[model samples]
Target chain A: MTEWHDAAAADALSDDEVMGLSIAGVPVALFRQEGAFFALHDLCSHGAARLSDGFVENGCVECPLHQGLVDIRSGAPCSAPITEPVRSYPVRVVGDRIEIALNR
Target chain B: MTAMPESEATYVVVGGGQAAAWIARTLRAEGFAGRLVLIGEEPHWPYERPALSKEFLRGTGSVEAITLLGAAQAGEAGIECWLGQRVTAVDRVARVVTTAGGRSVAYDTLFLATGGRARRLPGLDTVPAERVHTLRTLTESERLRGALGGAKHLLVLGGGWIGLEVAATARALGVAVTVVEAAPRLCARTMPPVVSGWLHALHEANGVRVLTGTGVAGVTGTADGIAVTLAGGGRLEADHLLLGIGIEPEVGLAAAMGLALDDGILVDAQGRTSDPRIFAAGDVARHPNAFAGASLRLESWANAQNQAIIAAKAATGGTAVYADIPWFWSDQYGVTVQMLGLPGLGTRAVARGTPEAGSGCWLMLDDTGIVAGAVAVNAARDLRVLRKLLEDGRAPLPDAWTDSATPVQRLPSRPNVGMD
Candidate 1:
């Protein structure tokens, strides 16, 4: 069963901006880029650093700790220092609200 | 340059450390279908070395936890690893390497990533004693970890990265630690004065006595413990003494081959040594860095992996240049300190965080107003953003640079006008 949770209001994050959100005690990162919203696990796969604090560039989030890059849409690691991919959440925007499907 | 062999020639890499593993992995990943061989001196697989001083020393993990390229992975990658085999000679002229195991292997391309050995204190016989140690391999770290368990007090003879790290680990283990540095400040060669002061304060706050401007004249074993005699006519005692001074490049095989070497094997930007057929990387290779405008040999883990990849690709007919800005990290007392780029001489250091706060970022800008380098203490996010600005030669607003409330990304990165 899929657990749908409202992580944040869609307008809270501007384009190319990232914010940290807690959905049902799961640390999640919300990223808005190119007028679209995406979500992924906030914790970096390489180290215990928050992905929300990472820099968003070229549709990828470079982990602040160690500079590992993860694709915002696919949660796939696109650079060195990180090999494992983060768990990406399916997101949908409904009436200025961001909904994430936590496949719990 | 030796001609490519008619038969299937093997891509041979000496030294089974991080650099060799990356070289082999990259060769196969880049579609080099030739035979691949890795000659390692250690019996175990290639593992990450930084953890030897951090998590592994703290008893939080085992050797298996830090293994980078295990046997199974090597088999899957079709790499023939000669573990515990030492290469005695590299015949660069004939394109063959002789191993201590009485075997000679010919290679179409060769990578000499013969990293380095820990620099021991001069005139010190570092036998397998419980009281004296120098960490360079897994065996050393394991022994030091075991010694830490029964040790009451520890004396570290250097204030470099390894020494400070081991001091922090010992302090965490409830071992009374004293770090004696010959320099006036901690990490004098690498760190800025502010960062050095910060590390000094960090160690002192955590019960580690940091004695600066003190040199160890001689070390002698006492009846029950080790005694360190200071050059200034003083003595200190400890259950164990560790020497974390520095490393000497393992250039024996390369030097024997008569390849060009000053402090290390000289390599070009493509990681090519003086000989076209042989390439070098990691601590053993001193190559020109475009950023620093000089040749340097970096001993960091990132350089080991990245430079080896470039060398591997170059061996396989790729044009990748190994000129990335150097980056390194050290973990001590729960603080992750990191550095990127070259803080050239004569640059001014500007702190982005409060110096008194003990955790902030320090930026070194060249006289031309170009951001040259950065050192971050627990402010990795800011460092990441600042790294880009440094790479782009952009300068941040002075008011916002030091303000912690202002996000680093929000600071404009357009190159500072008239600074070029």
Candidate 2:
């Protein structure tokens, strides 16, 4: 836990909340699933739906536009209209904060 | 756990569709000597699906053009046809299936080609009888076909593949079809956004009213027809309502049998599920894919046939896994659309054909630098190569589509039987 830098404070996103941010102008959607923060590319695989506005369940987010699913962990298109994986970022949380690297 | 025929080798096919027909045809082609029994709920010989949403939905489709095999010929092939009888339950343990007519049929090996049912419009109330139509079964299609006048008002619900195909058909028949989909773009649940935009343009050019990001709130039936009220605060008046929304696999019989289901009858690559003997196919069987390492429920005609062949081979003691690259085709507004591999874009994509040009293919690539999947419209020849590349894990140079696309000279014709 000490090796990673803070990407966001704990208050930035609530439980089961997904928020979008940009690091170096690269759009990313951050999801707080099970007290852990994971990030995926903002664009949904099937269409131009924003993943930030989707429903999160069982470690995957369902796209709001057409219900295409993506795994929060691997950023892979889990089901329907999407079979490709979304690019994931290395996110780490420090004391009372969240941090993500822009390497993706 | 396919039962070795006990009583006179009864090969009871529980459903009648292209897959079932292919199983019967392939059995004859492979010189199978089992007594064939085809129990179809539809009361007609199997037909092609290419016409179901397009030509058949309009009034121009003739029955002869769609039916692949005549009943007499099927009879000659020793396939006893049972029409209008739906199988209610399947007792895999007893190796028997019961129909709605209180008839129990024992089988050596049963083929569940039950297929799927068209996803209905939300709320069953207030829908006009002939005005609302779901294009899946021939009975429903024929009804819609007969009711489609030369210039009528049609409101199609959903923006999926089936909805768009019906839209193309209704538009061609000089009918004003307004497709209302809650999704932001058409085919958003299937194709890439680039392709969805192209399809949106295709439907728009053909004079179809495509309203996205809106759901059908309710239906109002009147003397003229039905009026579809949208969630986005608009009303669509229509003489007929054609629903092409989508379909869910008919897993009623399978569910009744208490078999394992991972959204469908879960099966391994060889089509073996929890219960060994009872294998499922067509929109119902969810099989583990070697490439994805996940249980995938593939709902394509190609997958249906491929899985059936694999299931047959496996049943006949051939230990082969069905590992064919999934392929699907759609014809709309006189354009041939072929979808070949699958890829998670932003990883990579090589455009072989310009979808905007109304004809071409796109080669999708994965991080491993291999052809993950490919899609082409009116560029079948290129897709064949792409299919090879994907299945064989071959990656051509990044610019493969520039020199790869060629006019599809011909298509593999479905086998036809002579009337004589």
Return the top candidate by lDDT.
1
Model 2 C-alpha RMSD vs. true structure (Å) is 21.0
The stretch of ten residues in a row with the least summed lDDT in candidate 1 chain A is A77-86
What's the true lDDT of residue A67 in model 1? Answer: 78
Tell me the deviation in Å of residue B114 in model 1: 1.1
Tell me the tens digit of each residue's lDDT in model 2 across B73-102.
687777777877998877776778788999
* Model 2 TM-score, all chains together: 0.73
TM-score of 1: 0.94
- Residues B1-420 of candidate 1 have per-residue lDDT tens digits of 336552366889998898888898888878888788899998879887898998889899778767778888899999999999999987776788899988888887888999999987766663336688898899899899999999999999999999999999999999999999999998887776767888899899999999999987888888877888899998999999899889999999998999999899999998998888888999888999977778889999889888998998888779989878878889888788888776534267788876437578887766777666778887887887776775665768655687777788787555743365
**Candidate 1 regions off by >4 Å?**
B1-7, B126-128, B344-347, B366-370, B397-400, B412-420
TM-score of each: 0.94, 0.73
- Candidate 1 residue B98 C-alpha distance from true site, Å: 1.4
- Docking quality of model 2: it rates as incorrect
Query: What DockQ score does model 2 reach against the true complex?
Result: 0.01
